[model samples]
Target: AQELLTKISEKCFKKCIAKPSSSLDSSEQKCIAMCMDRYMDSWNLVSKAYSSRIQ
Candidate 1:
């Protein structure tokens, strides 16, 4: 569980963080939030598609 969480965090950070700033700016924060939502949506879609194919 812990290992899986770490990997998810790493992937999300890479997708959301284009540059290393001292702190997350307002726009960056918003982008991160949206990116997270989109990532989850994509993941769910992919999982659903795979399951349907298997069935």
Candidate 2:
């Protein structure tokens, strides 16, 4: 869970955040939310595939 969050934070920050600010703007917030959702969806898909293959 920690690793998952760290990876998401790092990747999304780099992609969405042009500059490190004290707080995120509405656009940044939306971008991060979308980015995290996509990352989680992809992660779940891959996890399911790997689990099915192993089983």
Candidate 3:
């Protein structure tokens, strides 16, 4: 879980945050939300596939 959150933060920050600021604007917030959702979805899909194969 910690690794997953860290990966999500790193990837999404790189993709969405062009500049460091005190706070995020609405667009940045939206981008981060969408990016995290997509990343988690992809992670879950891969994890399920791997688990099925290992079992």
Question: How do all models score by TM-score?
Answer: 0.75, 0.81, 0.81
The better candidate by TM-score, 1 or 2, is 2
Candidate 1: C-alpha lDDT: 0.78
In candidate 1, which residue pairs clash? Answer: none
**Residue 17 Cα positional deviation in candidate 3, in Å, after optimal superposition:** 1.0
* Candidate 1, residue 20: lDDT: 80
* Candidate 3 local lDDT, 2-55, one digit each (tens): 999999999999999998899999999999999999999999999999999999
Instruction: Give candidate 1 regions above 4 Å deviation.
Output: 1-8
Tell me model 2's lDDT, rounded to 2 decimals.
0.97
Which of the predicted structures, 1 or 3, would earn the higher lDDT when compared with the native?
3
lDDT tens string, model 1, 1-55?
A: 5764575677778977888899988887777778767767877899999999999
Q: For candidate 2, report its TM-score.
A: 0.81
